[model samples]
Target: MMTNPTKMERRRALQDSLNDRINFIKSVEEIFNCHMVNFITGNLWDKHIPEPIKEEVAQLGEEKVLELIYHFGSCNSKLEVKMELTAPCPTLSKYLIACRQYYYDMTDPSINDEESIRSEILNDSSTSVSDADDNIKKRNLSSQYLTPAKKRHEVDVMSSFIAKMYEKKLANQGIIGAIVDIGGGKGYLGSALALRYGLRVLGIDVASDVTDAAKSRNDKICRKLSEKCSFYQQKTVFVTPNTDLGNLVKEFQFLWGSVTRVALVGLHTCGNLGASNIELFAATKTTDVPVTILCNVGCCYNLLDEKYLPEGVIDKAHYCLPPLLHGHSVDLPLDETSGFPMSDFLCQRQFWLGRNARNLASQSVERVMSQKKVAVDALFHRAVLQTVLLDYAENCSDTVQKKLLSKLDEMMVVGKGVGRVYKRNASLNLHEYLKTAFEKLDLDIQLPVEEVDKLSERYDCFKSKIKIFYLIRIFLAPVIESIILLDRLLYLLEKGINEAYLVRLFDPLISPRCFALVALK
Candidate 1:
């Protein structure tokens, strides 16, 4: 699309901003993408991001810094107006805030509201999972929803939206089939749709054990809803582009007769699953599967396959997971056809999001801030350990080094590379942490006390240097997410699917990966 910078600049509705998405991305790609490596690699203060940018972010009021990252997205209306760009900011911080300004409010009060959706449906529609059933009324949902209110809220909102969309689709197209929960982990959202909306749902996940677990959980929900309304079923399927679409639909119809339409949905389809779902929905128009709607919330941008660089060409030594997996998709060969930059718009430019940047995109500012303090310098701690390991490999005897460095390339890439995530445990001291880290790695070699002491001394200054830079990265987290979601939205629009929308379906506080890509045909 829409290429006008001035028009894209003015805050507009999500619908209006759809036109300029690719152009805005173009404007910021050079601005933000350059730092993808530095964020992942250690020594960001000196290596990648300019020193001035770090200084500005560190020096600013915490409120201002917090405002830059969290305020401009879909869920909150805390800010009355966009922060002024009149005052100069370091080029990175300024554009990061500005990029967020374009995000369509998730609670966007548009015609797509629930009342409007109800209006589109036929009057006197009667089928339902008895809303007043005492069994359901009496049982506590804490077990099904788990501990948090977030999952409950997400289920309540998403079920209502999916029910509305299905009813609307039924009225407009006369298509009536079950909602196929693609990559439906645990099946809570899909199960709730069936139990609450009286809609049939089939949740497909990858593992048989997961399928078994989903049914085990569904049994808990079904017990409350009464046996008659037990409409949710979980099946295992690795959903690729070439998956048996007609067969899946047949299975849906076979189980429940009079099935003519299917709505594809997912609550949190991680990484490639999310991208692949979009591709499947777009391609299903002419297929035997009479699909009318697609709703998905994608997370784990880090796991999403990036087309810009092939996996082979990229250095594995710069990666974190080897013995442990990054995700299920990594087991499969990298397919440029499946992951990020799905739309041709960015594909033409060969837009690149290095693995580290994509990994950084997965961070939730809300989750991190909830801990009171920045929690732990998990990144800082990991960075220092990686340096020690690298130094050990280089300086130690060949035999000792080989013992420590087995599959080192496949090991966690820490220095001038990336690291694994850790929980905030502020009480940890460097020596204690090193003792525990060595145990986990199972390294028998002894490290010098002097080296450990030197690193301990460096921790204070290193964390300070890295602190502001990390926040800035956290600030850009959603902006990176924006680019990914926008590309998918643009893909739908380009296919001439006019009814699609990027709905901010869940509360960000509870469900951090809250944006759901919803499209109706």
Candidate 2:
């Protein structure tokens, strides 16, 4: 039987394959820009959609598109949805099927299944000499621990995987060490590692309140372990790539005695922090100790710094990388310190996905399909509210228009709250609800009850167009998300870090931003 490739080998393979297809990335960006640019700009209301795409969608027939959406959207199961994408459409059938398949290909079942979890965890990295013994130990320990309250099953699995990886690193590298949890909110994963694996942990966060909470939580966990396990908290910014992590540890005097290696781990580190951790681990080189392992799961792509992109690509208008990278040459020099494609190569050819597109990328198709009606209703209501705001603005003076539109921005929040309440109580009167919500907003310009009723009545006419637009946006979500994830993966590979691996580490249905970027030296 052919054995699976090691993590480094896999990273190199992915990098080489993707890098060779620089033109393919450009083509993907063009397709998204052509089909999804308008959808990315704002809500799926009538005016937000581009005229050409709107005409094409209209020609495909709204009834057919709506039919296809409801047929695929109301699927009893994910498998059924994948199988049922056979409905014919003039333009959208191919795109709809592609979206469904993308979701299937990305879903990682082993993260949630108990029987396969251990093998999955062990397979994530290159096999060490003590693999068999480590697997057996992890299997025994998996049953002994209780998953913390309100924590997803995927997180439990991730903590166990990271803990096991830490052990493997310790044994293989022969370094007595401590685990540093960057952005360790509430110290849930850190405490678990300390209690279950008996590894000393230093949970770091920017918020003093969160650090204090993590300390209190760790105290309880240490008590339960019946052994004095050190779980320290430091409130400071630690994600900067140039920050001297070795000196920071020295200042805190954490795990000062006989500590020669550190395992840097972050469970769903937000925004640029994940990328920064990767850079920090690669750049930090101390004579006495070193960061041997780095594991990070990142979310919120919209928050990433545009400065991290190749030079001369940082457009002040947009805060996203793709917009800056689009239509540019892919050949740029790599950063010496981090190996990131600073300017040259495929990094120059990077595609632009707007903030809304990035946000949409994190949504789960399975969850959306399961809650199809609710999702549809929510979109329908949002579109209607947008229409109401537009109408209200059209009727008002310049000053009133500005004031009313500012307050109408709150309509999204109100709509979301109302949608949730409406789902539980189907008999809930929406018109009355809207009136109450709008009244509470206390806009200087009066939107009388009758005017609100008129807007609510227009929902029936707008529902079909809104539903079709929503479905199109949903169909393009995965494609846009794939580019964002690949960029990060490529950034690591460009940095010459061969051990970096991008693994689907959570169930997207429960946690949409579930991919973990792991590296070890």
Candidate 3:
């Protein structure tokens, strides 16, 4: 009555199944649009992507572009909402759906009758078993992801999927002895993995407040998730007060000298701190003990090496902009800690507009008194001074003081691109204004204006180089992933590990936000 499928026929059927899966993914992506598509596709990563990774990478990049757009691409601050992968691969999707179904089945009250229960179990259990059987069949059909390959192929793919891509990346083979998280605020990322994956985690931060907060959070999480992270409270240590990064590394090594497999994971490590971790890994090398992995999610690249060059950090006195901005080495007499506050930077450019308005108004008597270092309650009189600067002749009680501030404000330039910002009808060419300012400043100096211009040009050129460095750090994650693959190959050649595999499993919901680093030996 029925004919069995031939080998060739079976192969064709499998190919058709794969086509269906691919089409399903593509259709979902299209439906979700770019941003949502990126979030969802991240769960479908493979080590050797038969298809290009560029499409997903570009989609993920849109998340950053969205942030740039929200603040009108302001020089300071970024959009705060985090992008997450909501849908992963079909397997994960099914798992999630099944879990939800199970939860609902347990909690939801359904019409219960003896006959209905018996019928449902008899029919539904068989259907579920058939569905499970179909899932096993589909696994083979999805050859691109589940194709029979060497163990190494699977591991490489899995590793690429689970781990966040980073630069100067580290690969771990055997047991991870200790994980030191640098600038690991709250140790959320590191602690999570340590608890889940079973490792000792040390959270290193300069701020005692941050470390203490992380400890509290860790304790709270441990209390709630005692079953899952029972060892987390015991294994995790918070280290602070010693912000000196180099000294911290030395101390860490001294404490755990016997640890062979060490990993350093940092989420949003700021400024030059991220780069310092790389240097520590490269500089501190041993034949017996090796730093296995260094994972960093770096933010605020503008705060990197103060000098305009790669070698800037070596010289203590040389002050440069954080990796992201103009690096000027003619020290501003400000220490490493002195710079624009994150609060100020993260505020919208509108805050600068308020400052500009204040600058444009004429200075008040109170302002003059404050400038002369007189003890005036400048805050209380600021409102009165504002009205006087606008030339509103309101005979307020503080008219005399307001008049003085208005005059002073008239002398001061607004929108000079320094302290406060003012919006111009048309975009102001800040570079041109800077050139003019430089020329004017040279008028009083013995140095010729032409010489000053030459110096400015040199500084600009150096700043460009610094920008390149920042860009590299900004995109370090992907670059690191690539490097770690090469490291794995090298490790294979050296016989440090054997019969191992790696793979990158991407989530489909959050634009493949993370990879599942599968290690199978």
What is the Cα-based TM-score of model 3? 0.31
Tens digit of per-residue lDDT, candidate 3, span 252-279: 5544444445555554455445445544
The model with the greater lDDT, 1 or 3, is 1
- Per-residue lDDT tens digits of candidate 2, residues 1-521? 54555555555555554443334334333333322212222333454455555665666677655667666555422635433434345335554555555444432221112223234447633442123234424311232334443254554667667777766668555767777888988877776666555666677888888888887766665566565645454555645777655555555453445666777888877766776777777774554667877778777664554334435432122211133223322223323333222222345655344334445665555566666543455555544544554556667687876665444433321211222334454543445445544555554435576776776685566656655665666655655555555556556555666555566666666666766767767
Greater-TM-score candidate between 1 and 2: 1
Error of 2 at 115 (Å): 16
Off by over 4 Å in 3: 1-173, 228-258, 286-288, 309-331, 334-521
| Cα deviation of 457, candidate 3, in Å | 37
Q: Note the Cα lDDT for every prediction shown.
A: 0.61, 0.54, 0.31
CA lDDT for candidate 3: 0.31
Cα error of candidate 2 at position 402, Å: 3.3
Ranking by TM-score: 1, 2, 3
Candidate 2, position 503, lDDT:
64
Q: Residue pairs in steric clash, candidate 2?
A: 322-352, 323-352, 330-345, 331-344, 331-345, 332-343, 332-344, 332-345, 333-344, 339-495
